[model samples]
Target: MQKIGILGGGQLGRMLLQAAANYPVETYVLENDEQAPAAHLCHHFTKGDIKDYDAVYNFGRRLDALTIEIENVNVDALEALEKEGITVIPRPAVLRTIRNKALQKNYYTTHQIPTSEYILTHNIQELSEQTHFFPAVHKIAEGGYDGRGVQIIETEKDLSKGFDTLSVLEKMVNVEKEIALMIAISQTGEIAIYPPVQMVFDKALNLLDFQLCPAELPERTYWKAEAIALATVKNFNSPGIFAVELFVTPDGDVLVNETAPRVHNSGHHTIEAHYSSQFDMVWRILLNYPLGSTEAIMPSVMLNILGSEGHSGPACYEGLNEMLKIENAFFHLYGKKQTKPGRKMGHVTVISQERADLLYKANKIKHGLSVITKADGRSG
Candidate 1:
């Protein structure tokens, strides 16, 4: 069987490994934590930092192919592996560009991809000089993910919150709706696109709260969103699954927000709602198999299960049994042993034919489940 290794062992890696059971491949994971979410699921697990050049290089050299669960990995090592004929999905060059926010923004401009306006800042002082660019979002150039490297600079008064390193200051869009489109490209140049999904964020935490597949969009706006998303990913010219997050303005214009080059939370509902899940699509691309169908088996809503506030210890699930009793509801915990405020502990996907039914079940799951610590119980 062909051997493949994945970098990072978070929930994304865990889910990817879960999907690997049906394939004829030996899986390996490289991560520093011996008890990482994916460690036990893979055939082999190496406890090493994914960002260390030597660790990543040595781990990948023995594998036939390699992919990533996160973006902060060692790109130099991936480049070296590619040179030695080890397949690196999406190409190292793509990762290099996507890893840095400034480079990623410049790439959008250079390629004529529709995106928000922005200014690149080398430091806080440079960012201060862009006072006219107030009410913009400040995003650090590298090593930022899941709302950590991003800050809203509403005015000069909020300047202190900006990053002191290289960053991107993007003018915020007059967003009416947020949408995500999942696209997969094969090595042979074939493409498969999943239906767009509407995303709702927990504004306070800057994390996804819930999302509905086959987003509610006017015919014209849907086509526009699709065209823009297609253009954005096609410019990358690489073979891998991509999640293109986008903004729909009141004027019906669609603009690219950001892109993730792997299986993403936005597509998590695909596991139970689509004929081929995002994880399955990634395997097909790596194995050179024909792309699977992206058609949804039913309309679905997915809610993120986050740790309750004031909880920080061994994980506990409240009302899990009640959630399990709900028909057509799928619960997936990340296997994380600890609970911290705002941590993504799991997700629940509810599928139904009627939009009303989907929303009702989603709300039930959202209010019924909580990830907490037994000592703290459910905090206010």
Candidate 2:
């Protein structure tokens, strides 16, 4: 059995481990927590910081192929492993591009791909002349994720809060809506893409609040999302799944926002709604196995279960049975012991053959449920 080494032991890594169990493959997960969800399932477990060079290199050297559940891990060690003839799918070079937003945007420009105009600023002096209007997005080039390290500057007074470190000043295009699509690529040139999904965010932190699969976009928008996502995958030449986030403008313009070269939170709905989930596809890609069908069996909606505000320490879900009263509601909880405000703990997906009615029911479930505290017990 060919062993695959997965970096980062969060829920994504955990699900990947479960999917690999169906095939004749062994896995070694490198993570910091012995209680991480993937730990008990894998063939071997190594508890170490994924960003440390010697730790990551030693882990990659033992596996037949290397893949990651998160992009925050050390790329330099993966590069070293590649030089030593280890098979690191999606290549370490591609990781470098995806890991940094500036390089990622540059990849689009270099390939003649259409993207919003952006200006890079290394220091306070370089950004003396600001062509951008009042409302714009300032994104940190490195180490940002899940609505963090991003700010929407609406006034000159808002600029001070964003002037800390290396950043990219971008035009805050008037976005009509937001959408995302997930695509998987294999070594034999086989490609498959999940139907584009619509994303809704919480107003507070711009955190992903919920997702609806097979977004009810006009035929053209859906096609455009697919086209953009496919182009991104081919450009990366990656051997794994990618979630391509897109922005739909008020004038019906579709622009690429960001890309992730691994299993993504946006596609979590696929577990209940699609013929094959993204975790299963990641395993197939690493094995060089024939790609799976990406068809959705039904229209689905996903609810993100974030930690309650102003609570930490041991966490619990209070209204699970109440939430499951609705038919077709499936819940999956990440085994995180501590609850921090706005932390993503788990998600639930609702699926049905009928699209429109399911949308209504999904929204009801989303509103009626609370991933918050127990009325009687301690906070979270």
Candidate 3:
């Protein structure tokens, strides 16, 4: 049996492990937490820091192929493993470029990809001097995820909120809507693109609240967005799944917002809505199998369950029974014992033939479901 290892055994890895069970493969996962979601599911689980050079290097050496659930893993070790004939999805080079906001923006500009203009700043002092570019989005060059390490600097006064580190000051675009495309590429170069997913953000937390697959976009805008996503993965030319997030302006212009070179939150609905889930697609990529169909059987909406504010420690799910009462509702809880404010704990997906009904149930689930925890240490 072939051996595969994944870095960071979080929810993404957990889902991937579940998918791998359908095939004859031995799976391993390296994570710092013993209680990580994938730990119990994988054939072999090692407790280690994914970012530690020695830990990643040692783990990659024993695998027939290696992949990542998170982007913050040590890329140098992956690069070394690639040189030794072990396959690393997304390619170490791609991760190095995608992990840094400044470098990623530059790649888009170099390829003539439509994206918001950005200025790279070395420090907060330099960022303050760029006040002329006020009302920009300040993003840390690295380690930003789930709306963290990002700030909207509306004025010079907001510069104080930025980190004193390498970052990018991106000119905020006038966005009509936000959407994402899940593109899967095979080892032999075949590609499959899922229909665009419309992202709806929570204004209060600046995090993704829910998503609608097959975003009700005009024909022209939809095709344009697809073109951008295709061009992006082609540019990297690596065999793996990529999620291209985009912004559509009121004038129908499509611009690339960012890309995640792995299974993503926007594609979660695919598990029940599409013929091939993102988890299954990744397995096909790593094993060089023919890519699966990306067709959706029905319209779907996905709601993210974030930890409620002002509650921390052990995690609890409230009103799950009520949320599950909705027709065609599917719940997936990440095996996290503890919860923190704004942390992603789980998600709910709903599907239906009627778009309106699907969206209504999505909102209902969002309101009815809550991830809360008490100060006491135990979780139910």
Best by lDDT: 1
**Clash counts for all predictions:** 0, 0, 0
Model 2, residue 75: distance off in Å is: 1.0
Winning model by TM-score: 3
Cα lDDT tens digits for candidate 2, 72-115: 88999999998998888778888899888889989988876657
User: Which 10 consecutive residues of model 1 have the lowest summed lDDT?
Assistant: 371-380
How many Å off is the CA of 200 in candidate 3?
Answer: 0.6
Q: Rate the local accuracy (lDDT) of all candidates.
A: 0.92, 0.82, 0.91
Q: For each candidate, C-alpha RMSD in Å? A: 1.8, 2.0, 1.1
Q: What is candidate 3's lDDT per residue for 203-234, written digit by digit as tens?
A: 77889988998898999999999999999888
TM-score of each: 0.98, 0.94, 0.98
Query: Can you give the lDDT of residue 361 in candidate 2?
Result: 70
Better of 2 and 3 by TM-score: 3
* Rank list by TM-score: 3, 1, 2
Candidate 1 similarity to native, TM-score: 0.98
